[model samples]
Target: MSEFFQQPPRAGNRFHTDPSLRLLTQWHLPDAIYEQAEPQLERMGALADEVMGALAEQAETNEPEHTPYDAWGRRIDRVRIDDSWRELMRIGQREGLVAIPHERAYGAHSRVVQAGLVHLYDPASAVADCPLVMTDGAVTLLQEHDPGLAEHYNPRLTAREGAWTAGQWMTEKEGGSDVSGTSTVASQDADGRWRLYGTKWFTSAVTADMALALARAETSAGEDQGLSLFLLELRNADDTWNGLEIRRLKDKLGTRALPTAEIDLVGAAAVPVGSLGGGVRKLAGLLNVARFWAAIGGPAGVGQLLALARDYAGKREAFGSLLRDNPIHRRWLARISADYEAMLALNFETAAQLGQSENGGPKELARLLAPLNKLACARQAAQTGSELLESFGGAGYVEDTGIPRLFRNLHVHCIWEGTTSVLAHDVVRALGAPENAEAFADDICRRLKNLTTAGTARVKQKIESELDVLMPLVNDPREEEARRIGWGMARIYQGVLLAEFAEWKKSAFDDDAGFATAELFCRRGLVDEPFPETDADTAGRMAFGS
Candidate 1:
């Protein structure tokens, strides 16, 4: 008897192969920008398959090495990363992954184009997207604050040749979100130059050429509001760490290929970006950009798993036939596709808002949308990423198959920008403003009307009911229920956006995907809360394992 063996799945050009991505462009982007973006997206997709995909695998195997000393035991404190990792940065640089929006080549469509490229590049990036996110954030802040810093850093950050990445240093033992208690104190030297002295509890992308950090100025007497943003290079002319000590690299669960470290600033030479006071406010631009990146990352991560799962279904066999032919597997794949497609719509919607904001559109919408996008997409990705992993059966559990990384890396999205709960609170706070709440509700209602006009009345009604219930909760939300409030808003946002696009798809392309996705999002995306019947006593016991 012959032994049965499963064949490995194959993936083609990520951008070119995915209909939803193309569909989104057609739905959201201008024809002129779409025409220009399509070819570049094609190139990125090919590179994603032909080049970056292999690099992602290699980076996984050749994890970043943190060498604390040299060959002769010189205390260099070097974080040596894979050449493949280096190439990934170069690929992003050459491809204008972060530069697209700043370049303004496509005008207001720039962010949409950029989102498309990054969405395609992410799966193959092995979390190299981490540095790119920080770098993009750095670019946004520098451009808005200091002219000289922007000139010096923006070119290097956006370089097509020898590009550079930047780190985000904010966390410390004192707090993660609470910057008021940060112990990293900034003091000026005799020359009036700034320097930072304290420990950075969790500094990501430490191997980057530069970083934007938060430190409380020594001269400030106030509490949280006294924090300042400082720009610092990673190395000196002699290739030594610039007043920075890499205490140790973190042993993280995922993103092992991306170097994350705990650093002690030994008088790290720095330059203040803007006014010494309100550093957190100045850094908010960077945070917004980073949050957007995190939001897109959700779709990127899950989309990767979906591709692999769909491919695997065609190749792997079950009791009697290929998994692709199995009704259960096909149904699961359909739901995955629906969820993935719906989230993709939300990503581009947020991206479009960002693009418009650059060209003088409503900035407040983007602010509210950022938190909504991050919270919604992160939860969806986390939930579905794990399910998609199970679609591979035991093969997903194995490290070698490269499927687990999709899910493993997703955990950070929920925590990185802000935990789902943190974002929920932000949403609640943002919605506290009557104008913001009104604008948010108006946007959803408008989008839902499009689907309603397209004859998806049940879909619109379901979402309308959700909004009716959800609106009151966010308007006057409890601390514990903040997550539910945020998620409810995000889900409604996704559903309406999906419905709008499905309307376009139905009329323009006559495709069922948009209708299917819209219906699924309304049905599965919106919910009344988890186990409302279960008492707090039962829920507490279930959670505590008591």
Candidate 2:
């Protein structure tokens, strides 16, 4: 009986196996840009199967440790991470994970290519992408504000060699998403150096060499306008502590392999990135970039979860039959797959727009879509992860199976960068811009114009109606109204993207998977239909129809 045990599930190169990802990228990028990125994508595909697959398991099991002092009681404040974690970082740097878009080697399509690579790498990298997000944002922020800072740090941040990552330290005890409540005070010293003097409550990736932080500068001004953005170097030129004290490392729910800590700044030497009064405005760039990365992480995680669950279903047997043969299980898997496919379309579409915006195209719609994408994808990833875990039955509950980690890692996506409630409010605020609202509505209309299917037309009408109901309330929305309207808007937008992409899939590849996914998304996600149980044949067709 023991010898007859089922063989462990094996995953091939994630990039090569994911047809949806390939098709989406092909549809999104220009031929010239795709040609430039093809080699890198192929390399990443192979690495994802070999290096990342093993490292992910090692990273979760080993986790990270915070050693505040050495054996002699010196204030070392060293974070001891698994060797696998370090190797992952090295791989990220070597692969130009952070450099590609910034380098712009592929012209206007750089961000599109970079986003595609991130979608492939993030899930297998064991959340190492968290710090990469900050690093990339910091590089962009510095480039826009202080060229000298960019010249000094951008090379190292994006280095494929001796790269050093950056962190974003905005959360304090008084404020999570509300940067206006930040109390960390920045004071100019006799040498004209700005020094931060307060505690940062939640600083992830404490191992970073430098961080972009928000601090209120001392001034006669009575308002939060005194808040400023500062660049704090964690270590000095002599490689010594720079008046930063690590209070303790956080015991987090997930991403445990990435060190997160609370720290007190006592005269921590810093440099101002932008004008003191423009901190919030300047930090917007970083927030947008971070939110975009957070958005991509959702579908990437969902892809991994679905792959694991589907593979497990094929192998695991119950009552003289494989789990994949169970009709009810297939239905559940199909629904999750449909949601995943819709999210991929929505995410990559946003990615394409972001690339265009960077290359001097329109920015208004991307601004509105970033937060919406983040909120929708994060929530869906968490829900799908939970469902995938359940499909594995008792084995999923055990740590050894690695399925539990998917759920644990996904939960953080909802809370990190910004909570769901915070993001919903952000969507309302973005909609307050009349031009942004107009652009969002116009884009949806344009995409829907190409889809002639009756079901799709109905989805489009429903979305427009929902937007009609929500648009008027954007100016002065109550919290409950904002949440309701924001979620509705996100669903409608996702449905539109799916419907458009499904049409493309049918026309270009003669694939019905996209249509099936779009149908499932609209019926269940937009119209609130109950889950349906299907026979094995119907279940297989619906779930894996693509």
Candidate 3:
């Protein structure tokens, strides 16, 4: 059996053969894009695996006694592995991850979603709220403390510049995802310094070195209008919490590894991010960047979950046969495989588009696609993982099996940047905008018409057939109808796009063995499934002529 599986040749192992890792490393960069970034990506992956592996091993033994904030710490610690947290800052500095650094100073954010999954699972507990609020607070503080540190990407800085390992930014409280509702106050001191005073909830505030907090600058001739981002260094010169307080932690279902803290910001020393009144817009840039990373991290947990379930099926025997041999199990594998591939393709494209911001590219388009990618991929990851678990029968429910952990972790991604409903509204809003609605619609049409692969073409035709039924309703511009149309079009367009890429990959370009695994994404994402409701709607509409 050992000889058969052969341990999927590890990156540096004697005979490691992990197809997925190889796929990620190889196909992540297209030929045109791979030439420059390939080496960096590979190095990053290797470093990530090394740090992550060490942490995983430590987690097994160091399982600290369950504390309320363990989830938050664990998640942050997971991201800090090797140099991921630092690397992210470096990437942001180089070109502003999604136009936050170069264009907006406060957009220097981290991948809390990835860390959140692991942290939420930590023994310590808390109730769930927006993690982005916590991230905002952390990012602001770091940039303020070291103005030049935001752009530090070189490995040498890891040793030279001492900074907080990981922390969260807390901006949203009752304001929902709307940052304008923020009421935290920052008053200038008599000694010519600034201090923060307010109550903030859903703060992923940890025992880190700094925090990025948003508050209204204090003045006597008060206007509730002035909002600013402040970087408050939480740790003292001796590394102690001086004024910031973590009031209580929330208890939650998924992402227990990261604690959701209710923080009391009383006389917390702070500095502003950009201009005082410009904080909200600055945070928007940060949120946009956060949204992009959330999209990327969404699939990470899901992929891990699928791999776990696959391992379970391969090992567990039932009804006088191995689970892997069952046709039902095979079908489940195929289905989840398709979901993962679709998500990867969508996110990769989104990231690539975001990277183009440096060349004066269309950022609004990236912004439009960002929410869709975040919401769609995160939702899909959770749903897909749950479905995959059902295939494992009773075994998956057991904690020792580890399927539950992955399922819970993936669940957090859906609610992170924006909720599903929030995302749906955003997509509709984008569609209604005069600037891109027609172009977006036209883009959908072209994708549908092109029909890149046999597998995708069929799916595209099926979605179109459904859209035709909803056409009359869509033309009216009602929010509900528009949302339905938006979702359907995005999915269909994605299918077409994936199929086209699949066809391209199958052409003469790729020959490397590493691409072989990643190629699975191209083929699997293009597979067509039936959509009878769409077809039925179109038929009914055509017959009624109303």
Candidate 4:
């Protein structure tokens, strides 16, 4: 057999060959998955590399005021946010602005997309622009803030062509993540304007051009319903700031480049997204895509973190030996590498699954996996960042190394979207459906049976044990303990997936081994875990606050 055809297959590995860093070199996506997505990813790589390079340069300078900008001549341009905020807002109306420090939206989009991808289905109306809009939200915001740009509001272009930036209207003075407790009153004006009359705590208060605002609508019964979605455009008659006011910009520990603002709406001009009471549901469509983006971005950040660390280890000598030559450093690098691979495979699988989502309705499994991926990717990124940063000693603590910024940027992943606790609750919900969980688990079991690695077998046993604790709870419909038990079950599921992916990394070249490991992971994580709560009620509360 020829060299290419004779490639060996293992149980837990997912690659046609040993999955390596080079896997990204070729965007090998099935036509059904992303006919254009692979190309898009390729385009994004250049952008990512440029962004990383700019960050590296800025880090070397160690100047806080100097913003990171891609030195890449043209493809990736640099735009100053604070310097040119006025002009960029104008251009954003028509072309749409890209908003980075895209912490919340990124997490939301990534989680949703991850869920859809695992089921090989689409969660929204299968809208093509949804993904593009979510991905470009941060980028567009940067463009708008830069002085070189001009702002013009174009309703027609926005509705059709789609842009990368998005506005988040999630926080209320009463509660940030808890929408059920929201009291934002929405009344229809004589002129048919849906007026929102309430204070928003974190409205992207200043910079956001487009928003998915949540407010209560009056029903025929003279009572208010849960919430509704309003798409608000914040531009004016002479091309100036409309009614949306930026109360203040928050000074935060990380993502300093991305500004956070508290906003208030004084009879702000707005448009409805879908239906009045459908704000939660309508926003779900956008949020899903946002969550998926967040999940994937975490891994991307982790990759950048590891790359910088690896370079440092190879060159930095300590205690009369190269860092790589040191046993402790080697062990640390190995652990980080392994976690990184597990994260990548998990993120990629969900991405591939999302690319395959169609009209029939996304697989139910996707719903369950969204939280799992979000939890896994975010936690992994945070863990990897801390571990990798520690390996650098004092250099990791400073900005010049290019590792500290990554560490800072990744810290917020767990805070936004659906927090870790929220995700744990979701896993419990998935366990509620034993048949569904079992089917998901069974599929993984079938995959596990075909593996060759001892790691695969070990991981498989671990997953089975988790399912044993989870299955009964999932089957129970008891109301009082449902929420708590479900949360625990999700945690178990996540552990299984982590273990399974560990096996996949060890045997990426062996199809049988990889497949089995993937199965074991899915059975434990995706099939068994319940969906998490994304509503404001869960998000606004601190676990120990009460």
Candidate 5:
């Protein structure tokens, strides 16, 4: 026989295979909502598997190209992407990945269903979700600030055929996260039209048809009355470039498939979207939506890693036995699996709260949970991806193995929308509101009320005790202290969420994995029973000398 190596088979239909995700949707969503979303979920699941399995190799190899000018030196600033990328976008729009929530076709359950679909679709889309995040944010902002703009742009943004995406341009060279330092100036033209003249330091999806930006309106006030939000169309009605010049595409550590650029705006015609001085207030809607999207990406990436690692375990063998049969290997796999489950529980619960807020439920809890969930899930994804790579041995580190991308893609979630420190401060600010803090505490208690097992109850008590200590510090927490508290709060929240799901699964699906997962997560994450450190020789032999 010829010498050969065995490899794991490609993933099958993701929706059908993932029992936890299916149970999560059933447990969190209302019956009517689940029924309405079922068909769409199935379609997205199949598409996701196809994208990650058959088309993933080519898609990963394809990097977006920036064409700055036409052959005749006309300023085009075109970005060329692969056909596979375009097809993925078309599939996403046709599935109403971004539109369903905005349109509210399913009433109060729209956001929940939309979030679930995005969770399934994000991992295989090769960062196409980046533009979708901004597009969804723009839709939400426009719908509230200027209904006229929403009416004109919503169709284009949501359409599967002839779709047009939107971008967000906010960061300037001087102001990385501080919009108060915005120096972009807007002035009135001879025709009494608003025009923007400034440079945007970091603009993602630069080839987008339009962008929502922040520029200070030139006023005589001395107090620097905050930046105003404006909508700038990238092209004129005649298909010519507007008064915008793309400086160059950004060289990023990851997300290379998505084109990001720096651009200078000169006489670029714009229209004010919201109140002149209420720019920060108006941006709340976009920030909320984008943060939720950011939170979901982590779980989705971890799901991909778990799938790859699990498949490889059953196929690869050593010492005349399969890796899946080894207790040590199984322990590592179990830890990652439990972590992923706990993260999904937290993320979906937050999604449920967000959906409920749209129907007159408490909005404050959603506010607090969005940043917390994003920060925690992003951290989990990075750590889990690293371990999963190690679990696959040396093959995981290779590009062709398709494992490295998960790790690279996951790191972006830590920095995108907001960093851990930025979000930690936001959490502190949210908790400052008395009503918000009360609502959060009430929700956590409600989830824990049904814990029947003594072990689960003990875990719940520990989490509550931690919350008691953390809530008092919210009012006067220093930056570093606030970050530390934020991490603790996230662990408590995830533990509580996992316990709730465990109880539900025990009753409904007769599944014990959920309970086991919850127990493991609480013991490790909340109780702080971290794995012990080993000697250098042992670590070296395990990590490399094998």
Candidate 6:
């Protein structure tokens, strides 16, 4: 008898392996634009397999180390990460992951190309994508609000040779999401320079070159009108700490490779990005982009695991046949894949809308889609990630197989820019505004106006029904029903987007399962098929403390 040894799952180049991403890119980009972008996309895809996969494996074995002192025990406050992390950062810079959209050589399709790059990078960058996300947001905010700072910083932010990673410093000990209650204050020094004087409770990009922070700056009108956004350089020209002291690194649940720190900002030099008392309003630009990252992250992470599962199914034999040949396993994978397909479609739609806004297109539609895309996509990714990971059976739970990392890394997206509940409220508020509500209605009509496929008609009908259910909550804009409203809106849009993809697949590629997949996704995903009344009642009675 021959000894049995399991064959490890293999993943090839991301751009070539992912037909869904390829098709979407082809659909969004013209032939001329695609010709320009395809080589870069393919290069990043190869990096995903050759470089990032190894880095991810290395990070699992070795975490970032914080040494508060040198050998002589002086306060150096040094955080040392593996060389692999640095390599990942270089790839992000070299490949123009953050710079592509900002560069805009491809016109409106630039963001679509950038999104593909980001989705490919996120799964294996060992959470290096965290700093890049903040960097992109900082670049966007600085370019829009502060010209001098933008001129000084953006060149570094977008540079390929010496790119800068910017930390987002918003959460403090006093408040997590509610920045209005912030205690950190920014005051002018004797030199007429603004300085931040407070402790940041949590800062994820502790190893960043610079940081974007929110600081309390009061005016005579009210003593505390609101917060203002500030940009902080972590180091001086001599490379010493510039009025900043790292207290300690966070002992976190996951993302061990990403250095998160608690630090004291005592007289840290800062410059306001906008008006002194306008950060609460001005912060929308940064938050909007960050939420888009969170939304993309959900699907990107799931796609990573799904890619592995795709390989494993063809090789792993069970009940005298490969798992791919087994009806039950194959059907289960198809369902999870369908949901992943739905999320990619929706997030890419968000990307396209954001691109339009960037290139002097409709601003209101982008604003409305921001919160809706983040909440809905994050929630769906969480569910789909769990299901896909479980498809590997025992190997899914094994850390050595690199499968369990999906869940550990996935929880952050659900809470990163905003928690699920927080984003739901944002969606409701966006809809509450009259102009935003009007733009949203027009967006729905615009997205669904051209339907060429029969499946799209069914998808359209299903979406109309969901709109009937969810549109009322948006019109009334209640807090309690915000979750349903936000999620329902996302589901409807995803259904329509997937239907459109199905039509393209059939007409362009002569595929039939594309239609079935979209139909099944809508049927299963659009509404919460209510559980049995007795089962729910009993479950509720026995739940938790009860």
Instruction: Report every candidate's CA lDDT.
Output: 0.83, 0.81, 0.52, 0.50, 0.80, 0.83
List TM-score per model, in order: 0.94, 0.92, 0.70, 0.68, 0.92, 0.94
Colliding residue pairs in candidate 2 = 513-546
Query: What tens digits encode model 1's per-residue C-alpha lDDT throughout 346-375?
Result: 889999998898788888788888888988
Q: Candidate 4: worst 10 consecutive residues by lDDT?
A: 119-128
How do the residues 1-546 of candidate 3 rate in per-residue lDDT, one tens digit apiece? 355431221222101222333333234444543444334344434433444434433332232122323454531121121232233333322322212322322121112112222221111111111233234323433344435545442122222134233344554566866666877888877775778888787755354455667788975344443887777666678754546666566565654444456777778887776566677556555565566656655566555555556666767777888778989778668667766766766666665555454245665556567777777787777788788778667766876555566577666667776787777777776656655555555666776677554445545555566556544443444564544654554454455445655555555455332132233433443222323456656868887975
True-structure RMSD for candidate 5: 5.6
Evaluate candidate 2 by giving its C-alpha RMSD to the native, one decimal.
7.4
Model 4, span 296-388: residue lDDT tens: 656656665566666667677789998889998886676666566566655655544443342233455555556666777787788778887
Q: What is the lDDT of residue 210 in candidate 1?
A: 93
TM-score of structure candidate 6:
0.94
Residues 82-120, candidate 5, lDDT per residue (tens digit)? 777767767778888778887788887787788778878
lDDT of 6 by residue, 81-174 (tens): 8888888888898889788888888898888888888888888888788888888888998888888999999999988878988988989888
Evaluated at residue 541, the lDDT of candidate 3 is 85
Q: Which residue segments of model 3 deviate by more than 4 Å?
A: 1-28, 32-54, 57-168, 171-173, 220-225, 446-456, 466-478, 481-486, 508-546
lDDT tens digits, residue span 110-129, model 2: 77777778888888888988
Model 2 whole-model lDDT (C-alpha atoms): 0.81
Residue ranges of candidate 6 with Cα displaced over 4 Å: 71-73, 218-225, 525-546
Superposition-based RMSD of candidate 4 using all C-alpha atoms, in angstroms: 11.8
Error of 2 at 10 (Å): 2.4
Between prediction 4 and prediction 6, the one with superior TM-score is 6
